[model samples]
Target: MSIKVIVADDQEIARTGLRMILDAQEGIEVIGEAGDGGRAVELAQRLRPDVCLFDIRMPRVDGIQATRSLAGPGVADPIAVVVITTFDLDEYVYAALQAGARGFLLKDAGPALLSQAVRAAAGGDALIAPSITARLLSAFAGAGRSAPPAQPVEALTGREEQILAAVARGRTNSEIAEEFHISLSTVKSHIASLMTKLGVRNRVEIAMWAYETNRVRT
Candidate 1:
């Protein structure tokens, strides 16, 4: 089945380019386009697309607001959202991820990453721009960067700890499985456990928590 997507941006040209890029990808379709967050939310709630590709700055509502409406915590049956923006500023990246975005990509992330983000989001996986993954976290860590990260909720098994480190480094589940010589389902189980233990909603948050706690060092 095709992965349906909604593209939302304040600029018509940007929206058009994003739509074109997504439409050209195999198994991906841009089903709707919205110039503002209000319409973006309305179309999303009604159309129920597989993914939402949103720009951070919009007229009525920004991408973060729109994303929160569709996918934030406490939202039941949330839609998948991937934020694509020109700004790779720390605030925007953190805000979008905290708003429950499944992925974040720069406008210059190129067609390959754009399509990959859509596919990953549609498949219930999270992707942060590789170029920003490690640096984005460590750059903002401050003086606490050297401190060891505290374990969360409960003690993590040795395997879980390894999984957490792998995830913190932005490795996909398949990659983690390959690295650890485990099954894909096993990797997923460990990730799910990590999310529960860390009190996070997604892998992006998992990575953030690791960085914040100094678990994943520079």
Candidate 2:
């Protein structure tokens, strides 16, 4: 099935561009477009698309609030949201992730990453632009980069530790599997286990936990 998506941006040009890109992809479709965050939320709640693409700055509600309404921590029926913006600021990235965005991508990240982010979110996986991932975490990792991990390090098995370290470093599942000479399924299994143990909804949270607890060096 095609991954149904709602593209939300204040700029008509940007929305059109995203729709063009996603429509061209094999299994993705831009089902609706909203010019502001309020409409974005309304369309999302009504249409129930598989994924939502939001720009941080928007008239009326704004992307962060819109995301929070749809997928925030306390939301019982969260929809997957992928934030795409040109800002690239630390604050925006931090707020979007905290508001329960499933993925974050820069506006110029190109068609390939855009489509990949949509697919990943639709499949209940998370993807953040690698460029932002390291810098975003490292900026806050300094005060106590070596502090004790948020979760007991000993709680994880040896193999789980290895996988957690790789995840903290922003390695994709396929890359982790190739690096460790293991099957992709095994990598996913380890990640699932890590998420359960850490009580995070996605890899981004796992990465954050790893950094907060000093599981991986910045």
Candidate 3:
């Protein structure tokens, strides 16, 4: 099935460009477009697209607020959102993530990454731009804050720790399997164990915990 997407940007040109790029991809479809955040939120709530591509700055409401409305921590049924911004500053990025945005992409990140991010978000995965991830993670780490430590680490065997570490480094499951000379199923098993122990919902949260707890540094 094609991944349904809502494009929300104040700029007509940007919406057009994104639509063109995404429409060319194999399994992505642009379902709707909104010129402002209020409309975006309304359309998103009504359309229930698989993923929402939102611009940070918009009139009436802003992308951040729209994101929170659709995907915030308290929302019972959160839709996946990918925030697009012209800047990669710590505040904006952090706010978007806290608003439950599944991905953050610079406005100039190009079509390839934009498509990948949308698909990843649709798949219930998260993808931060590589150029932004390290910097953002470092900043979050250096702030001396940590996610609540998980008791599950004690249950993780050494091999599980190794797998988790690779995941923390942003390695995909296939890549982790290759690195450890294990089968893909083994990688999945390790991930499942880690998730069960740590109470994380997805790989991105796992990676976030690794950084927050000082277990991994970029």
Off by over 4 Å in 1: 139-151
| TM-scores of all predicted structures | 0.91, 0.88, 0.82
How should the candidates be ordered by lDDT, best one leading? 1, 2, 3
lDDT of 1 by residue, 85-166 (tens): 7866646667777788887888999899899888888988877777777777666543333564446889899999898888
**What TM-score does prediction 2 earn?**
0.88
Q: Candidate 1: lDDT over CA atoms?
A: 0.85
1 against 2, candidate with superior lDDT: 1
Model 1 error, position 24 (Å): 0.9
25: Cα error in model 3, Å: 1.4
Question: Which candidate, 1 or 2, has the higher TM-score?
Answer: 1
Q: Which ten residues in a row have the lowest lDDT in candidate 2?
A: 140-149
Query: For model 3, how big is the CA root-mean-square deviation?
Result: 2.9
Query: Global CA lDDT of candidate 2, please?
Result: 0.84
